[model samples]
Target: MNRHVTTGFLPGSALAGADLALPGVVPLERRRLQCYLALLFSDMAALFSGFAAAGWLYLGPDGLAQGSHLAQLLLPIFLTVALYNGTYSLHSLEHALSGAIRAQIALGLAASAVLFIAFYTKSSASFSRVLFSGGIILSSLMLAILRAQMRSFVRWRCGGRIIHEIVICDGGVPIVLPGARVIDAAAHAITPALDDPVSLHRIGVLLRGVDRVTISCHPSRQRAWATILKGANIDGEVVDDAVARLGAQGARIVSGHGLLRVSVGPLGLRARALKRAFDLIFASCALIALAPLLLAVALAIRIEDRGPVLFVQRRVGRGNRFFDMIKFRSMTQSLSDPHGHRSTLQGDPRVTRVGNWIRRTSIDELPQLVNVLKGEMSIVGPRPHALGSQAGNKLFWEVDERYLIRHALKPGLTGLAQVRGLRGTTLHEDDLVQRLGADLEYLDGWSIWRDLAIIAATARVLVHPRAY
Candidate 1:
């Protein structure tokens, strides 16, 4: 069961790797753009040809000239209305009848607008009303036929629908979707976890570039899956008939199953762009400003134990993926806990004099600015933790299921938990609970102003007592 059951995935597919293999499905967004352009071009051609043919048959060259003018005027207006009425949307791409009807409505509106303008401008005599009406009817028929043919084109081009959908079966009733990639979660050991990097990474790989994700999981695991999906930044749905009984807010009935819409991306495209730009600009400036200090620390670390000046440890980052986090080495090379299996206690023998001072002042973490520049971390978000990080006698995720939700955003150098003085090791379950609460809170209604406030607040805690 090392490899989960995957349908539609072909050998040598572009998205395949040693860990997971996916079908060479074109991205849904790109597919939709292609469909929209096809429809637009076809519609333009149909409109012009239908009107020109009618005009040439009715009043010769004079009518042909008038029809060309009419089509030019109608095209822009029709396109505008069609865009608003879902004529060129995903629903339209999926349902030919619905899209065709919407297209007719848009065309009707554009014709009415053209007639209204002609009447008001005393230009009604410029073209024969009967010929114009005839042209509209002919165009309507052509457009309808064109839309019907589009169904065949879409079936050929997109395999029917212009979206990528996946279904995950996790200890629940197995179901089928006509064209969706289905995965058996248990076969892959893909559980929703905050600290289990393997599980998170596997899940992330499974979901990359998916537009819609539907989960069928046991009732006990629904909440955990919901949290994971929220951080995944996709359209997430959970199948459960009892959602109505529980009063799920975003629930809907799809194909006879009750689907609870658990999450859309936490940040929209514009917001993510703004945040990334902020991180890059600031991280680059900080690195340049502190270059001399960074060199001094690195040189000192090398002089101490003659070990590598930087400690590179694998930590869970955004989307629950692992990344090598950089930090100035603070402990003896032999004693460093790469997996963070052990907490550093006060007066620990492994801490050298320089290591102790840098750890106290939080200077050892300065190298993580490089991680920020590399886009592996953020300046303000929930901090990433080592895979084996734990609280009390259990892993951090084992102590609290909601611990994973914080990972929806990039791991930050200083986060809400750090600003709130929750930087120490999770010695007990309650310690994790307190920090988890802060991390979850920070995920809500994120804004640039809030990030700046957190960054300002973080300065106060740089020399906090818990830095050990």
Candidate 2:
């Protein structure tokens, strides 16, 4: 039986030659950004409310005039110092709760110190150091407490909400769905053949198959279930009811069904055009500026081994078209045991010393700049997979048809997947799954800023050890 899973929002139309049902996971960075924004808005509101209350209570009487003047003078400066000291920009604030608190404290101390220095320098006669000190302490405490409380509240509220739609295939156990009643005996049934499509479909037809199921387990499991549902072309909501019901007890089941009605459509041409323009402009400038280094790398490759410096391999590109991808060769000439066609694994004997260096630093990818110039690729999009890579096969056959959405845009020289440690050899199914998920995510959330960020991250990772 063919079974697939998916989570979160489904696309409007399926891409040709791609799986229409494989579940794709949302990237951590995107999720963190959303959570951070929610926290920020809530915290800002809380801060203003606290300030209003404090003003009404402490400054409404004798302190009103002096306090107003002091606040006007100090607030901006304090905020600036706090931001600097805290490293409290929108970027850094995406970390976990404890990290945020530690940052806030550091910011608070620096802000307070800056205010103290400023007041001393000005020799402000009307300013009371005690009042200023008290305000800083109180403000810091309020901000920290409010942020923490809001974070907890948001998590709790979301815990009960359906954040994703998951479909279960390969009947392992009955999935429980939030707000769903499982009165039928089928709710508790487990089919060993749930992974198989024919058997699962038979079960679905027999039970007039359920529309939604819930499983109380780890968040990772929810993600897995969503993937399975997506692959099966069945869409249903994933709720936290299982978690709520299980709550440190035995495992709990929610509800899920075979009925999934969701649209998977291609991105509009306008977005496609915008991304293309961005790619041409940036790729052109980068290639021109790095010409000297690229030449040197080519020369090194040739000198080390008397083989083609540039390697051209067939890769699946936009619209499932075959394209010869260009890259610096990092492998020695070799014969395949089974066949000549195979992926290079880590520590492969075919890798030369220079090849290893180029691969690790991603210098081998430099020639793809020419591909970008020719309009075969973008500066940031999904990295094109080799035609025969295991990752490509799984994505094509096992995932949803919309999984090809990543190919809607031109293949990129550097992509969200590569920058997030999804590059290199795929020795595990999870690796390919993760890389494809990042690729789809890039397509869904494509933007100029995001492309730039990926490029920056790619540069950073190239210098790091794990990139190899």
Candidate 3:
């Protein structure tokens, strides 16, 4: 059965007749729901398997005692998967499968280590080490295989078999079908390049002709295509090969990487409001919970340098408002370069010893909790841009006007951009553009659960620094 599911990412109006749409082109609503459900189910199954395996291994007659350290360790490992599994969905299954498997293995090893420590400390009775190790190996393999299988199933079920009728507006460039069919095609007076100004007038005409539209172009042309399509009334889909646009929505089979840029517009007002309420409540609680840690970090910073404990700098907030964002001082006070620096170059000398550690560990950002409590920021959203950062100029000014829509919500402590390693500074104009695109994406798809997931993932990354 074709099920119509709504998501925080797509408007309900976009869902009309979406099931009949073509491959590489479904209403954003359906895609978001499908992706979220797939991730949710996979995580549920993995958690269940982990717990089941642990119980069978440690609680059975031939197993280790339930009260043993092995059992305690295994329980936490299982809990870890249950708590953190949602973060894995941030990446496409193909790219993250190996890493997910490795993480499962690491969880097993951590559990084993905890058990060993317990034994060494005489906190538990002796257990069959061989059996325990065997259990770990068996459970790890089983979870990995199950996760892989789940990913495969999701891919198969969501693959394109459905076809959508799309109106194509080609301004005279030889339109290549690449095998896909266009229900109706037209040539406009102005042939708009992907990077060129989108012909909203042309798009409105096309939307009236078909339920959806697909714009195919070279990779370099993608940004422009996206910009133009964003203004169109109809939902837009992208295809690596222009021909694939003719296939059924949710049925076209393509590599995951090709689907990365596919996105829809903002969620409904209700979802946005719900997300804001959630951010306020959660950010408040987080600030309260982390208050002690913040105090300790403040003391450390003060002792390390005779500078301000809290660094307040002008940052672009929601709706292009300028706010003095608060953070633990992680750099020695220095004036910005006269050239109007846009990004922090690698190994910036402005970083002090304590600053380096704090930045790496993300402890320097603890003071942002005050910002959160003050309702100037969120626990999760797009990270606020520095006052003169390239992203502010390129995205807020040069890109599509819709890009500024992201500022409608409060700035976030961590966001989809940061988790995707779009943090730090944009070295290139393209990078800033892409970062803003992601920010706009997050704003369009804001949700309570999504925010929670981002925050959790941020915690994980903070524990293991990669970008810094």
Top-lDDT structure, candidate number: 1
Question: Higher-TM-score candidate among 2 and 3?
Answer: 2
> TM-scores for all candidates?
0.68, 0.43, 0.42
RMSD of each: 8.3, 14.1, 16.1
- Per-residue CA lDDT of candidate 2, range 197-244, in tens? 222333233222223343333444444333333333222334344434
Cα error, candidate 3, residue 252 (Å): 35
**Candidate 1 residue-wise lDDT, 1-468, digit = tens:** 112212212223312332654566566665566778899888888788878878888888878887887788789999999888888877888888999999999999999999999999999897777778878888899999998998878887787567789899998767777788888887766786544456567777878768888999998888778878877767888888666543444877766777888777777544677898999999999999999999998889889899999998777777666678998889999999776777888888998888999999999999999999888899999988866677887877777766766778899999899989997778889999999999989888999999999999988999989999
Give the lDDT ranking, best first: 1, 3, 2
Candidate 2 vs candidate 3, lDDT winner: 3
- Residues forming the 10-long window of minimal summed lDDT in candidate 2: 7-16
- Model 1, runs deviating above 4 Å: 1-18, 25-162, 186-196, 244-249
Cα-based lDDT at residue 54, candidate 2: 50
**TM-score of candidate 2 to 2 decimals:** 0.43
Q: Per-model C-alpha lDDT, please? A: 0.81, 0.53, 0.54
Once fitted onto the true fold, the runs of candidate 3 whose alpha carbons sit more than 4 angstroms away are 1-269, 335-342, 391-396, 399-402, 463-467
